[model samples]
Target chain A: MKKYTYTDKKDTRSGFGAGILELGRTNPNVVALTADLAGSLKLEGFIKEFPDRFIQCGISEANMIGVSAGLTIGGKIPFATTFANFATGRVYDQIRQSVAYSGKNVKICASHAGLTLGEDGATHQILEDLGMMKMLPNMTVITPCDYNQTKAATIAIADYQGPVYLRFGRPVIPIFTPADQKFEIGKALMLNEGPDVSIFATGHLVWEAIQAGEKLAEEGIEAEIINIHTIKPLDEEAILTSVRKTRCAVSAEEHQLNGGLGDSIAQTLARNYPAPLEMIGVHDSFGESGTPAQLMQKYGLTADKIVEAAKRAMERRV
Target chain B: METQQLEQIAVQVRRDILRMVHAVNSGHPGGSLGCTDLFVALYFDVLRLKRDDQGKVIFDMDGRDEDLFFLSNGHISPVWYSVLARAGYFPVSELSTFRKIDSRLQGHPATAEHLPGIRIASGSLGQGLSAACGAALAKRLNGDDKHVYVLMGDGEQQEGQVWEAASFAPHHKLGNLTAIIDLNHQQIDGPTDLVMNNRDLGEKYRAFGWNVTDMKGNDLADVLRTLHESKNDSEVPTLILMHTEMGYGVDFMMGSHKWHGVAPNDEQLATALNQLPITISDLKDY
Candidate 1:
């Protein structure tokens, strides 16, 4: 298995902040609008640098979305930031009609996603955001793994035309990817090249997949690991290639098992490769107020869970 | 255009609204009839449209230097379509395609068909003000000095997003945008007061930090003068409370919410046409 290390840990929202600040300096048309959650979204850096370009929407997610859609009319790229719950579920119709159906170039940056959003409980933690946004015709849904990749994605989405839903989390995680790595929208990065089982992971689960790869190596089970960042436009080619070589796959994500990355990969494999796949995610349940570690552990989203799923997939490959 | 010429166009626009809704058998003509004069005045006299080399007004989606208009109360699309065609945005013949399959003139104003006059799709109510503020901010950012106008139904103020947008404009100082509410006091269910009273709407907007004005929307001269006066420079945004009857010109449909979305029958259409007598100088029918 390929080895990986991190010198420091940082939250993905801060990566978004750093990226948008850079975009504010580079792209003249990039504007930021937040629904009274700039500090939580880590957009203070962007606001400090370009105060004129930032708009405080004062707890109105729907209006912020509509305004962002309107800003696209005059060729401005607007990033509407809020919690994942508010960004997707709270103002879904607004995003659907104003931004997605209208084909407006608006970036919906959501922080505090999934079970890791800890202590705020179920009302604030949204597990169905990816499914809701990905269903929209013109929406591109992206959930980067770590800080570096999130920053790269934040900068990359500004240049791409059309609406996008960029999902990131609150907890600080390992920054495994390179700081200057070029982030492609629908491309998967292969972390390990092995023939036993292909492990496809996204968001914060990418690091757990890496850990599973290392443990499987120690147990004489060589696992192939691939990071599937962009959920909507899934890297089908990469997934098919890895699964074709391994004959089995394991999908891991910090979302529900019903309509998330697992469903996408299962659908892809069911149509094309038809391989034995095991998924590790929250199974149609809401999360509670607990520490990030406790919540993730209760939700069965650790390295051991991925390893177990990988073994089950390998065993089921008959 | 002269006031008499504008009034003549408005009569033709009322005729077009009646005919279009009558043809489709499924459209909102009550608010459409009420807002016809306002639409006629804005398109014919208020808006500074882009002209081509041949000195004809060019109708395209881009509204950078030109004044932009959005119909929030999009059920009244018949009036907007008529005024837009009369202002040379498209051919008058397209009015026959209202609510038909594969037609640019949708039941409500939509950008899905790439219509030049519509910038955003708005039938959902209370979203147009946010969109207008966004466009106005864009103009400010692009160094373009132009105004953005949006029209909403009086009952649409009951939507919470309207209050959200109402608070947004003044806080952001989107003075380049103007919002007008057609205060006919009726919606699909019933009278707005019986459905839900907003108390005093002018005071609500004023408390939210907007420069408020009232205008007689059915009166062509009053609409022209009030709209012109409200577009003056100010630090706060402007809201024109336009008052008119639900069915202004037609006596049968007037002062009632029953005709809000109901289409007039053949006999009723004839009665409406008779009441709004068409002139040769009024409209070149499609």
Candidate 2:
């Protein structure tokens, strides 16, 4: 087992802000819009450098989505930022008709996703965003694990010519992935290779899965850790290849058990290869006011939950 | 174009509106008839559209040379399609394809089927204004400076997103954008006042920070003059409150909400066509 160390923790949105700044330097067509959450979404850097290109669309999320779609007409790549709840549920129809159905080159960058958006309660957190966004025909859903990966994904989506939902989180997590790692839109990253069991995780849950893999190694369990960032594309080849080797799997994410990353992997496995699988996510319930760490433990999204789910899935493998 | 010629086109547009609705047996005629003259004025006089002298030649130009129009209240597709056809965007014969399966002209105007003249899909009300605003912004970005026009039903003012867009354009100072409200006072259920009272729309737009203007939509001269005036104001996005009878031109259907979404019967269609001073052959060449 390889022990990963972190110098300092940072929220994934800062990585997005940095990536957008880099994009501004490289591509002049990349513009940004925020719905009164510019500071929260970490878009101040981009706003400062490219003030003319940055649109502050007040507190109206619906108008923001529409304006983002409109910005794509003259071949401008628009990145619209807001909270996950308002980004998806609040402006679904706007995104549907304007961005998604219209096939506009708009990146719907959402921060503070799922239960990890703690203390804001269920009203602010959204667990069904992945399902809602991925269900759209031309939508590309990406949920980066940490700061480095989020920055890489943001820069990457600027060149991708279609509607993309880039989901990130509020909490400062481990920055384990290499700083120079290139992000492929639909490709999953294999963290540690093993055959005992495959653990697929996304967003803020990736660090937890890595920790679980280290703990499982102490118990003589070789867990293969795979980062499934792009949930819509679902890296089916990588998932099936790993599941074939391990013969069992455990899926983890900060979203709900019904329509999160786990549900997507489960459906894929059910059709292609039958494998024993356990899901580590929030059950059928809304989140409450709590710290990020407390909510992770209370909602069964910690490293221990992943380790337990791995053992349970291995037991069912036969 | 002369006022008399524009009036002749308006009569022909009204005739097209009646025939298309009667053919489908399921379309909105009242607002379509009401907005006929305004659409005609926009396509014929106000807009810098590339057309031949005969008004039938498809002016070959790159996508960049195109001037765009979006019908936010797309229930009035008959008027828009008629005007587009009359303005040489496509063949006038395509007017027969309204609401028919395998037709580019859907019940609502959409770009999903790659309708050449339509830049965005706009069947769903209140969404088109934002889209038009987007297109207007795109024009600014492209440095094209081409105008973007959108039409919304007076009843469609109930949508919150419309106000959202209304508030947005002026803040951005989108001078290239123009939005017209078909102030026929009628919607799907009944009169807009009865269903959802849009109290003083001109004052409402003024409150939302738009340069407001009013015109009698059925009157060709007023439609042309108001639209021309709207183009001159470069600091604010223009909104025209086009006052018109729900069912204009047709005697039986005029001044009532009953003909809003209902198609005229066979006898009613004949009477409506007879009321027009122009013949169908004169419009068929358009």
Tens digits of per-residue lDDT for model 2 on B53-139? 774535421224446667888888888888888776777898888899999988887666666566566667788888777777777
Candidate 2 wrongly placed segments (more than 4 Å): A1-3, B50-67, B91-93, B277-286
Off by over 4 Å in 1: B59-62, B280-286
User: What would you estimate as the lDDT of candidate 1?
Assistant: 0.91
TM-score per prediction, in order, is 0.97, 0.93
DockQ scores for all predicted structures: 0.68, 0.50
Cα deviation at A88, candidate 1, in Å, is: 1.1
Best by DockQ: 1
lDDT by residue (tens digit), candidate 2, A49-136: 9998888889888888887876676677889999989999998888887778767788999999988889989899898899899889
